[model samples]
Target chain A: MYSILDNSLTLRTQLFSIVGSILLLLIIINLIRREYLKEGYSLLWLLMGGLVLIFSLFNELLFSFSNFIGIDYAPAALFLVLIIGLMLISMHFSVAISKHEKRIKELAQENALLKSMLNKKERKRKTSKK
Target chain B: MTKKSVCIIIPAYNEEKSISSVISSIRKISRRYDVIVINDGSDDKTKEVTEQTGTGILNLSFNLGIGGAVQTGLKYALAKDYDIAVQVDADGQHDPRHIPQLIADLDSGTDMVIGSRFINKTNYKASFLRRLGITIFSNLILFTCGKKIFDSTSGYRVFNKKTIAFLVRNYPIDFPEPESIVKLLRNGFVIKETPVEMNRRATGESSVTPLKALYFMASISVAILIESMKKY
Candidate 1:
């Protein structure tokens, strides 16, 4: 049974978790507000911030959950979650980059084809005038 | 039946030295066929050379590789309602003289026809390693599709309107020659090959070097496998 005063989390750990979660939430909100990050991506960051906030407020809940997951240390479990989330975000970015690259190639090809057609038409006009 | 119009697609990249000669050779063959040159972001006088020939030219804003360039030409052909589309290299290697043979084969209801150098004999010779790579690709394609293709890497090909429409919608972007054959076979398109003589390149270096050839073989093999597993 985990108690609030189980001494599993120190005051410094609690302060760090609260401060870090607040900072992440602020950064994510600002990014979305500035249109630097899309809403779809901001949702993921917001969820992470919420999780951090919840774990920090209820230290007992985090400790119990870490024990349930066979983790000896509660903070390690939080770090593990963060690592997995980062890996997923990075993978998503890679897929998005591949799609954009394909689109850019298609656009470039279309631009070239249209330019050539315009040149041909201009030449035809000049020839007819001559 | 009405007469079918043919469009000759030449995908050239920095082939200023040979583009004019190639255009002239095609012009000598016949005036009935419409010629379109796809300048794949040539950093030279390729566009001007093609323009001087008074042929239709499509200048790409950037280099999209050979497959992308060829597909762009196919898109143009499809848009213009061309009945037949022929692919000829910008370099003088692909002789326009054999284009008639490709068209004649297409007349027999063939969906796609390939101008192969190794059909009857090895008229055009490559390095031993290159030949080995081509042979491996041929056998691999044969094993997977149950179709024997002697010159799987030859870009000299003819496609009917149906094939052009299909390619315009779906075509690979890299090392597309061998892989496209597998795709065409999987889609149940009838393909035939005719003997054609290929010349050595008039100028400029080939994109494929020895190291790149190895990489090309590996990637092409994977592409063929993936293409075969795709549903039509």
Candidate 2:
């Protein structure tokens, strides 16, 4: 509805799509480095974002292919599907992460216990010399 | 303050209704021992109740079972340099008043003091099967450690610094007693027993159902045997 020029708004929408994809990519990257997102698993979304960004940059070719595939607004449909799929996958991964948080806590407590034991042994050795 | 400082560690799981009275009972004896309650990821008001009682609490964000909860408590005692450590239940099955007797044994230089129900009398009100299971395992613990342990599964016990240090390093996550007794004896640490009458749980059901009791006995027996085979 906001299309000013016939093809001009399509160009603007493609630019917006590319920018949004890049922003998502940046967020995913930040999450990866922060250890909130593990690697190999997150690589799929990163690549998908990149693919969407690339698809947005080439407009005429994608439209021609969409016409060939007999799907109206293939780019928009693909974008919607990808967003919904990613949301579901993100939800699934969050559940997995939530499940592992307990294990991580147990590991942390075990680590603390190991450190405590080591310090006590060191103390014992020092005291034994006296 | 060198009265062989004892810290009673209670590993709580979903015992909000009973934990306050547990805390209060301990508080009555708080002048003798510091109470530390490990609220092990209860999906209830366990933490809130513990906090209301102003007991020292370590709130685990998720459930790590009773074994992990108790180990966390042991780690805390080891870190804080507590001279003696006691494990008590938050469900109020074990009386807090019996804590002094364990400490008294510890004061007499017993490295570990276990409150045994069968030590003086056989009036323990456990189910027949439970009594049988305890008898079999306690006998095995006696054979392995060369010391008769009338109650191998009692949580009410005291450990001195040496035993605490050893336990913090290697706590049996399951079937802790039979293995622990043997471990203490093998390490040349003194172990003693005291008689304490226990009450039926004030709230909550025992985790050991008849079916679970069978599983518990088998699993813990295996765990103890495996632990015995492990070198140190």
Candidate 3:
């Protein structure tokens, strides 16, 4: 209800979207170069950046896209797509986390096993030496 | 039959009050059987108490829930190369006296033996809600695995070395008892259920709340379905 964004893409917002998309793409590339982001993830960010760049470049297409999708509110259509994109990214992270969680569990189990074996050996050695 | 080396895996989480008694009772049952307690990061003296009894113990850095603790014990069993591994609750719910019978069942040509309370009439009792959950899970397991198991939720179980090796690699992390049955059954492992009486827990109340129970039901149902859908 608080969405005051009109169907017309304000030039100021259009400029911001273009700048933001370009900036996001640059940051993602820089992150990959700095080893902060892996190549595996940089591709996803770059694709998102390309999509945002395409939309920012063509407001006419954005309007048509929203109209085609039955979203009367053009900005709402963009928001919806952005929300879905966020959801997908979150889900990808969740899948990655699940994989790592299993590994962490195995590591913890192995750690306990080794520590217990050491504990057993130390006790046995102490008793036998006495 | 050759004499089999057995490991009694008791996954204890803050079970300090009853762990000592549980260990002693198992030791009383047989000295030949090795006992290992996976101390699930209890702030209590569970590790110390277990050490005093001279039984082996794995002190996890944090609570890994019941499934993780049990899997740790399985890993230990696999590493130690025990012929059979029987899991007993550290809360004193499972009687150690039945270990031999479970091992016997395992030896009699089954990969797994579950100490079921429903196979025969026993003085053991459970709440109506809990029983409803048990019924639902057992049926879910049956539907997924094409076999009727009376007590899918019973943790009092004995696993042969092969099963232990499998579970060490694939045991579920949350509420594993029911899903493990489905996984085992689907993978062509035989699970035999025998009637046995279980003592009411001697110390703390069950950790299950109503909401957790609901989640447990839903998660396990989905897990069973997914397990059944796998091709191999």
Could you tell me how far off, in angstroms, the CA of residue B153 lies in candidate 2 after the best superposition?
A: 0.5
Q: What TM-score, computed on C-alpha atoms, does each candidate reach?
A: 0.87, 0.64, 0.93
Comparison by DockQ, 1 against 3, better one: 3
Per-residue C-alpha lDDT of model 3 across residues B1-232, encoded as one tens digit per residue: 6799999999998888999999999989999999999999899999888889988889888888899999999998988899999999999999888988888888656999999999998999987767888888889887777899999889999999899999988897776988889889988999999888899999988888988888877887787788778776
Q: Which of the two, 1 or 2, has more DockQ? A: 1
**True-vs-predicted CA distance for residue A11, candidate 2, Å:** 58
List fnat, each candidate.
Answer: 0.91, 0.09, 0.78
What would the TM-score be for candidate 3 when compared with the true structure?
A: 0.93
Interface root mean square deviation for model 3, in Å?
A: 0.6
Worst 10 residues of 2 chain A by lDDT: A1-10
Give the poorly placed runs of model 1, Cα more than 4 Å off. A1-14, A48-80, A124-130
lDDT of candidate 2 over A22-94, digit per residue (tens): 8988998999999898896787778777767766777675665555656566565465657876887788789
Q: Which docking category, incorrect, acceptable, medium or high, applies to candidate 1? A: medium
User: What is the DockQ (computed on Cα atoms) for candidate 1?
Assistant: 0.70
Q: Give the range where candidate 3 chain A is weakest over 10 consecutive residues by summed lDDT.
A: A1-10
What DockQ, on C-alphas, does every prediction get? 0.70, 0.07, 0.80
After superposing the true interface residues, what Cα RMSD does each candidate give? 1.1, 4.9, 0.6
